[model samples]
Target: MFKKLLFCSTLPLALVCGSCSSLYKVDKKTYVIEVNNQNETFNNLSKVSGVYEPRKTLHDTLTGNYLLRYKYKNETKYDYLNNYFYKNGVSAKFLKFGIIDEIHLVDAQNSTHIFNTDEDSQINNVSDFIHPDINRGYKNPIYQIQTNNHNSINSSFFNQKLASSKLIRFKIKNNIYWYNKDKKTDILINSKDIEKSIEKANLSSQQTNELKAFGIEKMDFKANENNSYFEIKLNGNFKAELFLDLIINNKIFSAYSDKFNYSEYYLVKNDLKHTLYKSVNNANDIQSVLIKYNAAGKVDKPTHAKHLLNEYHQGLVSSNLLDDFSDVQQKQLIRDFNSNKGIKLSVVQNFSNNIVNTIMFKDFIDEPDKNNIFEIMMYGKNKDKNSQISQFYSQNNIDFRNNITQIINKYTLNFIANKTNYYDNFISPNAIISNAQNTNYLKVIDANDHVSKGQINLAKNIEFYPQDLKKNYYNAESFLNVEKQLKSIHFESISKNLSNIIDDFYKENSNLKNKKINFILPLKLESLDTRIIEKLNKIFNEINQNLQVNIVDINSEIAKKYYNFSNYSTNNTIEYINKLLLTSNNNLINALTNSNVSQYKILNKTKQLLNKFIEQNKITVNLNDKQFLEKMSEFSIKLHNKFSYFEIIKLINEIKLLYSLPYNLSSNIDLDSFKYELIQPWIIKPTREDNLIYFEDIKMEGKNE
Candidate 1:
């Protein structure tokens, strides 16, 4: 019985030992266990742990190495182990026993660490260790770890090797950053590097040409020691300040490289056709910048006018259009428009010079107020002559019914009337406004006002003056009266001159009375005054019925030759030669006789002679050099000497004789007939006696008989 008991006990003990050995078997596979924690001390402990657990007990007891991948807001840690402990494994009892706050599995083959935390415990003081190779990877863990702060591990971080490489570094606002990499680096960017990059940049032909035109090749760029700022040395006429703003504001540097990306800095380019502006912020880490360039062929009259109108309508008060206008004038225009008082426009069309003058007034029907009026004159190419009015209308968009008070043709009498009105009211007209003599209109208005002040004296050209007016009744009547009076005077003078000429012809050739007498007159027969023509016809009938007269214009070639030859023989050869010879100076007479100088030149020569005489004689004077010279000038003379007076009288007589000869010789012709009767002067008359007394007396006598 004792032997049987021993055998049974030994068999049971052997079976129990076999089962325990199998349950405690160790996992030899490596594992990468990740854990996350927000606690600062835990993160610090992980960082200090390196290849081992931070706590001494854990480091002594754990089986793997530990590493803090990176420390950020929430800490992430990686624990690598070659050997993993299962829930029922021999090392699992240490974690469950909770002797330490955290447990790590240490791989004896690789010496890597994997973290395992015990519930309701903390890590105490631990020693630091060497950092492990973060590039290593591992298999799945025996027991999967779960934590609240864990994230998806970056495959690149584990796969890629950590090595230093070349990178471009730049600073914006004194903050340095890597160009190829998002993180900061010690590599700094200098101006030379930027210049090289720009040189090697892939720029379009247009962009390159623009830069060349801007004189970029003449510019030298240098950076500060820290490369926080850049200084550009300008050469030639290159404007550094302007270019800095242009390049930075237009983001032109971005065309050089793709790595340039700064969030706080940017550029904008604005092209408004007439003007261009580029804006940049924090250029070269310095101040912000703005650049402007005005385009060519801009701000012309029509364009400027259009801009002014648009700006005015948009409530803008100041513009280049108002530059010439005073503040008061501008205010008047603005006030009238704003208050709906209305503006008046008068367009004077000048077809002769192909110009249109636009006059603006403060109000419609307002009297000529120069202060409230402004004028704009438009000139254009000949081809665009007819488009001026259209352009004005298009630019201004004025209301014709309300704004157009009058449209005056510059050549018409109405323009003269308007000008006179302005003058009469003591208002100075604009430069574009011109004055003219409208005799008919002036006569009526002046007569109504009982003022003889408006008559224009044009006695020099009586035939051309007081132009006939057929449309105006009052003007036609007045014109007829003037025509009759002028014709009567001319008729009497012409009749007397013609009668004397014919009488002389008869007296000289009495035997040729039967021959037809042909009288060639140097005047336009058709244009001669009517009264003179009628009187001449009467005289010819009374003198000789067969007499015939032929009229030729004095300006005609034939008439001009005849008159010139006659004057040369009668006046030039006789009177002029005699006068020249009579002069005291032999040099003057010789000069006049031989020189080819004109009459004007002769006058100049005479002045020089007089000056020489004065200089030679040393004439008495109490004056400075300037005053003496001025006194010697022809314009300074107030009185004429006896010889000068005689010469002037002779010249006047000669001119009158030459000018009036043609009209006097050829006055027997009519041009235009008067359409209205002349007004006779008012004459006083005696009071008429009543004829009823004689009628009554004859009736009574007849009844009594």
Candidate 2:
């Protein structure tokens, strides 16, 4: 038997090995699988297959066919685990593997010999190879096949491979198929390279199974409810912790988080079953420990243990500045890293802990873009005194302290609406742990204040002018414009008039004409979206978010719908839009026919309204026959509502400058002075239902006025 095992290693080929020497591997030079996008090949640099370095295998081991398996996405097949329950109380999904009769019939002419082992057979009794339901205690041949992807007698074969995702370790089993989900990748480990790996690891075969004990790789850290102990995946723990320690130690822990040099002091009890002593190392030999870790599986007896010290003083070599927020799991990100330079990271607020800490890259950023944003947070015991500095770290000068700081502190003087104006909207958010500026925050040394209280409100209503200035003014170009028109406005006319009226009598002799006037204009507009209003009107019996007349999305949809057919014409689109708006009729036919109020119920209603408008001479749109009937379409209220919300805000901002005092000022004033009177006008674009004043054709009596 031992001689046979020796032959299996010396000669290898694609041969399936069963329990009693049925499978044999034939040597055929060497095979190399092309790992796309990865420089490392599966050439067995590490000996013990299944997360085990190949070199760790026993030289005197039995020879047999070794099935190299790898699963990049380690999905749990717990649903098939006999009595699987969920994280909650949900029943597990259908099983992926089950027993099938030998020569199972899939159909009349197609017969397949099932080699799958039923876990239920083991659960019931390891000796029971079959179920009592079949001829030989196996499942009946499932004839009614819905899908042939899987191989179960009753459609139970796993269509996907079950290689564990995340690195894992497991001893090669005799005759069993490991199942995995369809979302991961698999790689075959090479035996020859593994022998070299074992030599490189420099360990006897006694500890070969140490890694294999960790059967599966799990990412989530789980704790025993008894509070006795906690189990952490070696790979999972290092990825998250090191990524955070980078800021503290001023080290970039993108890829080098795994297997750091730390001395393992195992205490052996002198007394048979009595006491064991524990000792401490105050980092005097921390460098030595680091060297040992660095040389793990690579160096000699005691020398490898000391190499970590050499690594420490050598200083950081190179780094890849990752994004502040990435869309990848930190572990996977690190796993994907060929070099440890910058890493994608994110520090978020934990409301429960009342602290802001770095959330794992996996939890926050999924596909973390290469963004170099870094933030320094200073935690304080007092919730009110906590502060944080967000630095948009740039890749250009990240190695340089000066350049990195520039990216972090730089904020362009751009304007945001009231909702996004972090300075003015509520203090940092209730959800955020801290939102303050942390300048050169010495957090590590300040242990007690390692946690910040809250983000600071550095500049609310940041001003361009001083309060004591005699004639200071700020242009309100960035303010909101009414939704009615897509033009900018300056509302200072009415505001200046009011200001002068007040100054004339209030401070006539005081020479207060140059006194700066602190003023803001508020436009009182009616609620739009009566349908939405009707809904909310029924629900709360009051107006809520319905007042917004922005139709950005709807307008785009309207534009896009016609762009494919009519090249996105406003005029052509409007006609279809009008039909859509006139939900009560067949507006297409109404536009097509000059007949006054005739035909179908929908057609009659539209014509009746148009005829009434024509009799009243309120119809300004010259809807001739040629332009009337283009096959029309309408949008659902829900879709239209979405369009209105965004478009209205744009309209408001654009029209604000156009309708301001300069357009119809009571008196002449400089453009600079005129800019400050009232912020700007706000346009309101209400639908027919939203605007009670709107009916029939849109009539602008005040367009030239």
Please tell me which predicted candidate would have the highest lDDT against the true structure.
1
Which residues of candidate 2, in runs, are more than 4 Å off? Answer: 1-171, 175-199, 202-454, 457-705
lDDT for each residue of candidate 2 in 248-268, tens digit (9 for 90 to 100): 111110111121111112122
TM-score per candidate, chains pooled? 0.18, 0.14
Give me the displacement of residue 683 in model 2, in angstroms.
Answer: 53
Backbone clash tally for model 1?
Answer: 8
Query: Where is the poorest 10-residue window by lDDT in model 2?
Result: 671-680
